[model samples]
Structures are given as C-alpha cells and as structure tokens.
Target: MMAPATTSRPTSATAPSTFTSSCTRRTDGVTMCAWRDSGTRIVPTSSTSTRCRNPATPTRRTSRSVNSATRRSSRRGSPPRSIPCVRCRIRNRRKSPPGRSARTRSRCRRVLSARRCACGIDRIRSWLTRTRCCFMRRCWRSCSLVLIAFVLAACPTKTEGGGGDGSFEVQDPLTRRLMDPDATTDERIDRVLAEAKPGNTAALPALLRVMRHRSQAAFLVVSDGKARFGYRTVELRETQKDTRSMERVAAIVALEAINSPVALPDLVLALDDVNEVVQNHAARALVRLGNRAGIPTLIANLDNRILQRETANRLLEEISGKQGFIADAGWAERQKGLAAWQEWWAGIQASDERLPIEGRAYQIGADAEADRRIGFFVDVVGQYQFLFHEQARKALIRIGEPALPFLREGVERARKDDNATTRAGIAQILETIDHPNGRELLRDLLTDASGSVRARAAEAFGNLAGKGAIAALQGVLGDRDPGVPIAALDGLGRIGGADALAVIRRYVPGEDSALQEAHILATFAASRGREQRDRTLAMLLGVSIATRNAAHAVLVRITGDDAGYDSLATESARKEAMERYRGLLGG
Candidate 1:
C-alpha cells in the first residue's frame, strides 16, 4: 500500500491560495463565499475561484450592495453575512457587452434595477407598526370622550333658576307667595288683585299661568222639581279649600284694571276658557281695552244664556256705535242685524281704517242714579225714532238685573195695548235675563193674543229647553199662523225627550210636506234607537215624493247605507228599491 500511494500535487491554474473563506446562504436561496486576503481585506468570491485570485481588482458587489443584502436577509429570516459572494451580484446584474450602444446599456440597467434594494424593509415595517398603534390609541380616546359627553347630555339636569323642590321659581316674591299651596285663598287673591296694577308687566307671566287652573265645581239643580236641570253659578269660598277659580277671576279682574294693551292677547285667549265666569271677565276686559277685535266673540255670545248675552250686547254697542239686532230683534230680525254688521265689517276692512275706541266707559254700580238712567232708557225704548229705540234697548240691557223689574212692567203695559213689537222686545229682554222667574214670564207670554208675541215666546222656550214648555208648544202646534206652528215644531226638537218625540211624530202623517219634513228632523233629533229607525223606515212609504226622499236621506245618514235607492229615480223604481231596503232592515 505504501508503494501504490503516489504523491499528487494541485495544478497552478485550479489551486486556491492559503486564505481563509466563509460560506453563507442568502434570502434568495443562493450560496455565497467571502475570502480574507493576505492584506486582511474581505473580498467577495465569484462562482469560480480564478476570479478571486486578483484581490486588488473590484468584484461585482460593493459594500453598499452587501449591506442591502444583509438587511433583506434579516427581514426574510435567512442567514446574514457581512458581505454577499461576488457570484450573486454578478448573476443579478445585467452585463452588456463592451462597446454596446447607449440605448442597450440603459435597457440593461432598467431590467436589473428591480433586483436591487436601497432601504431596509424590516426597519420600515417596525416604524409602521409603532405609528399605527399610536394613531389607533388616539382615535379610541377621542371616541370615548364623545360617547361620555353624549350620555351626560341625555340625562336631566337642574337649571339655574329652578327651585330645590324642582318647580320653576318666579322672580317676583309676591307672585311666588300667591302661588304657594299653604297660603290662604282669600289672602292670595287679595294680594294678587292689589299688586296686579295697570301696566305691571312683571306680574303678567305668573298671572297668566295660574288662569288655567280650575277653581270652580259645576253642579246641576232642579228648579221646577222635574227632569229639567238648570246650571247654578256658585262662588268657591276660602272654606271650600280649592280657590283656583277665585284666583283666576282675580287675575282677570287685575288684567282689566291694568288697562294695558299688552294684556290684550292673554285676555283674548281667556275668552275661550271652559269656565263661563272666566269667559265673561275676559270679554269685559277686552271691551275696557278699547279693542274692536272682541267684536266677533261678543256677536257669537248673543245666542248664549242671559248673563253672557247681556254682556255681549253691552260690549257690541260700546264698540261698534251701532245697535245689535240680536238684543231686541226676533230670530228673522236678528239675521238682518248679523248681515248688517257683517257688511259694515267688510267695508271697514276694505277701507283699511283704524277702529277708534269711543272713550265710552261703563259705570259698574246699581246705585239710585244708575237706576234712574235705566228707567229713562226703558221709557225711550218705545219712542218714535228707530235709532233712539235701539239705543234705549242697549242701555237697558247694559243695566242688567237692575232693569229686570222695569222690563217686566213694560211687558204688562204693552200687553194691555196688545202691542206686538213692544211685547216682543220686552219678552226677548226677559229671555236674555235667563232668570227662573223670567222663564216663567215667557211661558205665560206663550198664551198671548198676538201671534207674533206667541212665536217669539216659542223660540225663547226652544233656546231654554224648558221641560214645561213642551206641553205649551204641543198646544201651539195647531196655531192658525204658520209661523206659530213652525216655531212650535222647532221648540219640540230643541227640547228633545220622549214626549217631544211623540209630539213630533203626531205631525209626520200630515199632508203639509214642510211640516212633515220638520217632523222627521225633530224625530231624528229626539230619538236615537231602533224605534227611530223603524219610524223613519215607515216614512219611506209616504205619498209625497219629497217627504219620502227626505226620509230616505235620514235613513242613509243614520245607518250609512244607501241601499241602491236614488232620489231622482222614477216612482216604480224607487218603490222597488225601498222594498229592498225594508228587507235589509229585516222588516
């Protein structure tokens, strides 16, 4: 074996020098080697060892390229070396042959540019992660603050001017004390009336707020010992405990006493109050303020009960300088009066003229001097001049209850002469008084010899809904004058009851189409059950086409069923359809 081992030596071209070398794998999966030269310089080795012998010559990769490769290898979890082997740089670069054109060299550079990296990718990723985390934290903090602010805003909080007990506190001490529950009603009302002087705007808000409080209890009393109920107005004293009404009335009075135009809007709103007393006070306050805006309200009140009508007439005369036809006129005459006033209003509006208050202040006492003036006006009501008669009627109405006695005396005197106009005027005045005795007096006037007086009395009874008046109206249903019978039928309908319905039914069979129509309307108004529907169905067989058509209309209105019947159809077709309607009603 020693003789067979012959000595072998490396050829000069293929032998490597006695230098140290290291090998490493790059991120791109290429093996690279670096050599340590004799001068202690690190030189990158190419694929072939022959290229590494000339260590003084520059290799494909510089120190900058090696640093970039090291950074790329660190990001990709590959082994990192101080320098990349020359073989990798040479393989990645595009080498144009020598003497190539400039365009070829430029294309070669662009083609290899993608393989080279300039900055550290891993360092950029680390900076982005830190920046994104910081931005998200700031955004989360801002959103949390906004959510907290929204939650706090949704909850209720005490305002600066609120009381500890959570009620809105008024700035005025006297108003606060007046509104206190512990205070006596009389004492509070007295203080409110005393302090709420004219032009005291400071007390207005508190006073207006308390005006809506209901202080009165309503009750029905039987005056005639029958089924009829009459409304009685009673004042709630301090002993009653709840004085809201007393306070509201006092507030309204104070607003009137103040006589300020600023209170006009509040007073106007008070006109529609549920309490009659409040409405009365508000209306009078508007009159005192010298504003004609209350004219329409006063006109509407002409149809109300006695106290309100009296006040309405007084206010109307004071505001318009013209007599209200509603005061002394009959129903037909009142229509004329309304028309005249409406025309006058239209003219004033077209002209755009300011309505000047006539400085007419009404005196408010029932002294002897006031009584004498009332008596003089009562006498002048029978005077020759129409204007003087109207003015006198207005004056007597304004005197209110004090003129009732004189008005009764006038009624008796006019009855002796059988004066229709004078008796009507006096009877209407007494009706407007709406006293129990005044109603009785009107009942007696129903038997008067004058047809005109009887007709007017019937209308008054209708408006009053007099239970006793039903019998008297039934008797007048046969009156010679058509107006008397028409008025009687109207009264029966207005005073609706079982007896009134019976009375209306008696006239339904009559030949007078007008009276028959009135009967059907009154029956519908008084009765509202199977009995009325049955009676109305029987009326469809009436001889008069007009009466049958009217009854058909009432049936449809009550039941909301037309039953295929047409009013303008021929008699045979209408009869056939009516038969069908009867079958539908299970007749």
Candidate 2:
C-alpha cells in the first residue's frame, strides 16, 4: 500500500532496536510521529522524518501519563530518561495568546503536560530554585504588618494629665470631689470629716494638701455679719464659711486620728492658722500626740485673746507640769506673768546641769546595776525629751518606795540649784507615791518660785486625794498663775470637804469660763449624795450658758436626768429647759 510506507529510525548505533516510532495520519492529510523506548516507555521526541510533518497528529503525553510511565520504567529497571523533543520544550516557553478557544486551551494543557514529562525532575528543581528569594520576600512583608499592629496596641496613649517629665501622676479623688462646685457645703464637710477615722493614713497627704489650700475667692462675709478673709479668683465669689471651717476641722481631726509623732510638725504649723478653733484643736492634738514641741506655741497662746486661750493654758499645764502664769490677770498684769515665765525659761537654759545627756552618755539595759538605772531615770526626767518622761516615771515607780528617799533628796537639791526640770520630775514621782511626807513635800513646792514647780506640786496634791494639803492648795486659789488655781480646784475636788465646796462655789458665779469649768468639776466631786446634788441643782439657776451647760452635764451624770437641756439649742430654748429642770428640783 503506498509503496510499503517507507519508515525511518535513529541511525545512531546507541539507539536500541526495541525502540519504535509510531505515525498517525491526521484529517489534514499530514502524518505525525511519536517514539517509545523499550527500556523507558513512551516518550515524545522531535523528528526530522518527512512523514511526520503535522505536529498535532502525534498524541502529546500528559504529566500524569509520564509519571505512570516513569514508575513502570523504574520497576522494569529502566535508567533515568527524558522525552527527546527540543521543539516541544521551546513551545512551552511561549505564553498562549489571549482569547484562545476551549479546544486550543486543551491543546495547550496537553503540550505543557508533555513538556513537564520531557523535562522531568530538572524542571521542578529549576522552578523551586528560581522562586526561593521571592517567596521569602512575600513572607517578610506579611509578618511586618502583623508586628506593627501588635506594637500599636501595647503602647499607652498620651493624656493631658500625664506628668510632663514622664513621672507617675499623683491623683487624689476625694480632693477633686471636694473641689467640685456642684458638691454641697455639708456634703463636702461630711466627706472630709469621714476621712478622719482612725487608721485612714492613706488620706493623710490629701488632708495636709487640703489644709494648705486657700479658696480662690476673696472677702467672704460670714453668717454672723463678720468679715472673713480668703484667697479667691476674680470669677469666684461667696465661698461657704462652713466649707473653710470644715477643711480646717478635718485637718485637725485627721492629725488627732493618726495620733502619730510624724504629724507633730503639721500640727505645729496649724497653730498659726487664722481660725481660733483650728489653733485650739492643733494644741490639743499636739498634747494628745505627746509631742512637747507644741509646748512653746501653747505657752504663747495663753495670752491670746481668742477662745483658744484657756485651752492653750490647760494644755501647757498638762505638758510642762507648770501653772499657767496668769489665770484672771488683766492685760497689764499678764505682761508680768509672761516675764516670770521668760525668767524661768532663761534660768533653765543657763543651768548647765539641766542639759540632757546626749549620744552614749546613758544607756538602759536589763543587766545594768541598780545605781546606773537610777541615774538614767534621773537624767531622763530632767531632760526636755518629753517622749522619755513616761518611761522614766515607770522606772521610778518600779523602783517602788525605796526610791522615794532618793527622789525627795533630788527635789531638795534641784530647788537649791533652781533646776526646774529636775524639781518637776521629783514632784511627779512624789505624786505617784502619795506618801504623807510626799504630800508635805508637794505643799512646800506649791509656793516654789518656778511656776512650773508650783503646778507640778499642785498636781501631786490632787493625786494624793487627802485632806492633809487642802489648806496649802486653797491658799493658791488666789495665786496669779491660772494653772495654780485650776490645780487647786482639782485638788480640792479630790479632797472633798466643806471648805473645798465653799471655795468651788465661789467660782461658780464667776464669768471666767475656764474657772467655771473647774468649779463644776470640783463641785461634782464634792457633792456626795442626793441632798448635795439637789443643793447644787438649786445653785445652777440663772448662770451663763457655758456655766449652765457644765452644771447640766454634771447633774445628768449624778441624777441620770438630762432635764430637757439641749446644748445645741438657742439661748432662750436652753434657758427655758433649765427653768423646767429648776422647777422639777423645786429650786
């Protein structure tokens, strides 16, 4: 048929005879050829044969088919192989034109498949090697975006209230609320006072800040038609009087509540406040804190015209064991009392022996000799270190009656040397002893030149609670020093006799509030039975509100009847209430 279709094969001697070429006639009337190796399998190959001119006629092997053939060839022990078709490989390198038909696309896929089989492992290896850098670049870009988002979330945003130099800001919420204009005066005062409870130390700094704060308004008119001064901005007016009072009161209450020696400095500063109540509270808080540093201020305030004068005098007497120099003296006579106090202060300062031992001059130990301990007690008492005074008193007390003789000798020696501190310490010890001789010794000190010495002596007499020194105590009732009279009244209360009652009654009608308070206390002690209470109730009529209030409190304690008295009520209301009580007592 057609002259037996002459065939052509590879002429090389290395080409095996088992390898064969197939030819297929296409509809276009052209022939195409494919080659198969006996050892490998069917593989596409470019041919120069004249009968194989139509490229489409030869069936191009797909990658799937090539892989199958490769697996079969490996099992048959064929060597590594590839399709020998250079033209097909060059065709795979060109991109297909746009808008190719489905059949054309199918043809392209087949060509690509055949090209993959021809290239085999070498094509895959080249692709991976070429794309390594680009793959890493794409992965890095994705990771960078995710990292940027995380960093933004972790950082804090800047705020207007943040510290300018990158320090942590201090914020007090209660203080901010207090400053709010919407807050009522009563609400603010109540909140500030609530912070004054014991153990609320965290509020201490804020309370101190509040104390130092000045209102931004100026020229406040108080409710009682008085002019009160303040600092205020031009925009602010009419600051509440109660608001300022509450702030000051809160500060004093906080100092007292904390009751710490560390608050002593602030309490001292508060003594200089313009408010008389603040100064009074500060002095009292200082005494409660057991800080003698406030003693000077209290002494200075004894001459103050404010209501705090009596309070300051009382605190000074309590702290220094000294009589207030001027109890009922006029302004001119008070100058002499102040001079006497200065003279005593100067005398103690000039005495080298009165100086307290500092550093290692004294050390207390359980193993120390009795003589050494006694010396330490003496030094501690003489020293101005009020903190150690209580401890020293305890040591002497522990020494018991055996130490009384030594203390008595010390008192005599101190008086000769004009050592007021030592004499005061001796007087305190003798008061604790309450011996018959101790009472007599205290009576002698009651007339000592130093007002402090006389005050301590009077205190000792009151503690003794015996009628032995009542005459000596009564003699000082007319003494110029305020503390002496007060102490005498207190001593007479403890002793309790007709003469003491008569002296206390004399002060009940007096105008001095301090003396009146002392008189009420003394009478309360001297009144022994129901008859005394009824008699004292009769005497309380028509007194000042302060005196009547004191008498009402005493009557309530003794008789368990408040007598319809209300301290906070108006003057007329209180008077009417007192009149009702008097009628009940048949006065």
Candidate 3:
C-alpha cells in the first residue's frame, strides 16, 4: 500500500476469475483446522487498483461455447460474467474454407484424439496406483500379519527372554490351570500324571481319583506300592479287567506286601485261577507262604493236567522243602496221584495212534509227549537207571508189556534184514518185560553171533534167580573164555542158589595160573563183607606163599604191579563189575 502494488490477478476481459487463500506454516509443523458455515467475502474495488496481463487465456482451460453458455444461463439476474479469451472467440467464429476436405477434419480429430489419449494415460496410471495401494492393504490385513508374526517368532528374540517359537508357547488355559494348587481334581490329576515326575506329592490327586474310580488306575498305583499299606490302599484291591486272573495276582501281591500267614488261603484259591500267569504267580506265592498247609494243595496240583507242567514242576520243587509232604499222608496221596497219572498216561499211550502227537503229549505230561516220548522215557530209563530204578522198572514193565508185540515183530524184521541193534533192542525190551517168554528170548540171544547180545543175554539169565538160570550159569562157568566164566560166576553168586554150590566149589582151588585167576574172581563175586576180605587175603597168601614163577606173575597181574598186564587185568575187573551190576541192578 505504500506504493502502487503490482497485482498478480489478471484484469483481461476474457480471463476467468479464481479465489485463493494464503497460509503460513509453523516451524514445528502442527496443523490446525477450522470449521466454516457461510461467510461473505470482500472483493477488491479500489480505484487505484493495478491491472496485470496473462498470456494464457480462460479459453485455455474452458471452451468458448462453454463460457458463452454459462454467461447466457447466468444472465437472468444470475452471477457475474466469465469472459472467453480472444483465441477461443476467434476459433468460435471461424468457418471451414471452400477447399477444406475430410482429410483436414481427420487431422483435427487426430489432435483431439492425442489429447484424449494423454488424459486416458493419466487415468490409467492413477487406477494402477490405487490398485497397488489396495493390494498392499489386503496383503497386510489378510496374510502378512500371521506370516510376519510366525517368521519373527521362529527366530528367538531377546524381548521374549530367548523363547524361540510362540507355537510352543505355553498359552493353553488348561495347562495354566494345572499349575494352580487349587485347581479342580480332574485337571490336577491329569497334570500330575502328564507333567510331574514320579515320586512327587502332585501324584496324590491322581492317586485319589484312582481310589474313587476303583479301576486299573488304582491297580496300577497300588501295584507300584505308591498307596500306603491299608485296605484303602491301591494294592489291596483287585482291579484288572480280567477280574478272576487279576484277583489272583492282586491277592498274591498283597500277600507278599503283607507277608502274613493269612495269605495261604488266598494263595491256594489263586492256584485255581484260569490264567496261566495268575496260576503261576499263585504257585510262587504258595512258595512264599512257607507254611506246611500249602503242601497238600501243591501235591494235588502236581498232577493238574490243565496247569503248565513246567510251572507246576518248578512250584513243586520250590515248596516241597518247606511243606512236610514226604512225612505227611501226602506221600500216600502222591502215590495215588502218580498212579492216576500213570493211568492217564497209559490212556494217552493207547490213544497215540488216534490223536495228534502234540495233543496226546500235552494231555499226558510234557514228559510223555510222543511215540518219541516213548524214546525219551526209554532214554530216561537208561539215564537215571539207578536213582529211579523202581520207577524205571515199573514204567518199563508196563511199556514192555504193551510194546512187546511190536518190538517182537521189529526183531523178526531186524533178524531177517541182519540188523543187530534192532534185534538187540528187542531182546533188551523182552528182558525188561520179564514174563515167562523173557528167558526163552534171552536164550535165543545167547546163540547170537554178536558178543554184546550174548553178554547181555548171559547177564539177564544170571539175574533171573531160578534153577534153570543156575544150570545156564554152571555151563558158562566151565567155558574157556574169561568173559563167559566171569559173567557166570557173578550170575551164580547173584542167584545164590544151593543147587549150584558144588559146581562153585569145584572151581575154587588149584594154583594153575588160569584156574587160580578164575577162582580169585569167583570168590570176589561170591563172598561178601568179612568173607570177601578173607577170600582176598587167602588169594594174596596163595600168591605170596607160592614158589612158582607163573603164580608170581599172575599175582603181579592181579595186583597191578606189571604195567603191561595191569591194563588188561583192570579192564577185566571193570567189565566184570559193570556186567554184574547191570544184572543185579536189572537192565
């Protein structure tokens, strides 16, 4: 206002008017907004106003027709005029010239089309920008949030105290609830079993739940001995799904826990459990009872075909020492039981041809398993020959009595085929049969070319204890072979019959080396106790007192002084002893 200010506002008649405000921005850049309804604005009308010129006209922004039309519409007491510039007026007044052709109009259209293309390009760019912005927003909202969080969580962060992944974070409400001491019992039980190590007091709630449920949980806890010793304790009650079997297991376990005599009845009842494990455990528990009262039950179960024979056998062995079964009427009961077993075994043997081997074997006992168990029994007969002499004799007596016909046929076939072992086995079985025909079969064996058969026959005949057997012994005593005569001497002495005394006395004297040798051996077999010692002394006196070199040599032979003859003489004693014992011992 101090001087005439040059105006930035245009004063041209065709210039369009525009109003604008000036704003001053603050240094700290706090923005303020004002609300306005309606207000009157002052237009500058001073006479000393300065005018300015603008090279670009209003027609540059709006067409002349548009400006003119606006002017006409507002002329009826409307608004102030908006003038068109001279270039737009000049363009509006121009007409096509006479030579103007379609090509020229096309050229004009091309310029207009170029302008439209530029506008379209701007709009397309704006739309693409908006679309990209929308896509970025959707990606953040729909997918990236979880993905970013997951990726960030994968890397351990110091802000989270180095916890790696939030996926493994303990955020489950139930899990948190379990940490509280006042949590519900169900939750507490689950937590203790799942999280707490064994022997923790936290196990108490689970133990309580087990008690109330009265189920396998109780059984398991009690079995572990976690519940203290009491009626309410877990171990005291039977809780297995198989109640009958588990009852036995529980009772046995409880008995062991309590270690009382009161467990005896329970253990015995457990023996009747159908479950093999329970039955076996019961058997073991009875052993634990250590009372004589359990012996009868154990002995009774010894023949129980339903029970596992091995377990039963083990139980019998374990408990037999504690229970006075050998002194009790139990032995008699055992004998009856053995007889029953034998009878049952006999039935199995009789049924062997009809039944499966396994079924037959299992039915009798594992020991009597097959036609081949017949072989095992045969082997056992030979193995425990002395210890189970009576049992072997009885069992063989029964087996031989039945198997004789088959063995006889086998023997005949063996003889026809020149099979010595089969024939010998048959003869051996016949000897064990020990019937009237046994002696006759053995006599036939004496004629056999096999020396073993003949020796076996001689021993069997010697053990027969009869006058006919004695006559056979006398004949063998006169034989030249040392084996035959020595065997005869043993047989006659074993028979011990008065009828053979003269023949025995006939061979007692004579210093002929061979005769004296035979006499010394005969005397050793015939005499017993003091008589044996006397006979040995007499032989030594005869040898020592004699002046003959042959007698001295014979004495050296018998006394093991000459190493050359020592082996022979020693072998002779061994043979004589073995054959003689086998005869006296039977089979």
Choose 1 or 2, whichever is better by lDDT.
Answer: 1
> Considering TM-score, which of the candidate structures 2 and 3 is the better prediction for this target?
2
- Choose the strongest candidate by lDDT: 1
TM-score (C-alpha) between model 3 and the true structure: 0.28
- Greater-lDDT candidate between 1 and 3: 1
Query: Per-prediction TM-score, please?
Result: 0.31, 0.31, 0.28
Global CA lDDT computed for model 1: 0.57
Q: Order of all candidates by lDDT, from best down to worst?
A: 1, 2, 3
lDDT of model number 2: 0.55
Error of 3 at 432 (Å): 3.5
Candidate 2 stretches with Cα past 4 Å from truth are 1-369, 416-421, 502-513, 529-587
Pairs in steric clash, model 3: 222-235
Listed per candidate, the RMSD to the true structure in angstroms reads 28.1, 33.2, 36.6
lDDT of 1 by residue, 1-587 (tens): 01111112221346423333454444433334555533346544455321122222233434777656644643433323433234433433335345645334333433233234345767444433533234445665798899999998997753212112333334555556666666688877887788567667666656654563443212101112231121111121122333376677788888777665444434655665565556666766766754444556666766666566666676656556766655665777766766676777778758955455432333324234334334444555565656555544654544345456766767776777656677776666665555776777787778888888888888778767755678878878887776677777767766777888888877643577577566665677566424555556656766767667767765675557788887677767777877776676566
The lDDT for every candidate, in the order shown, is 0.57, 0.55, 0.40
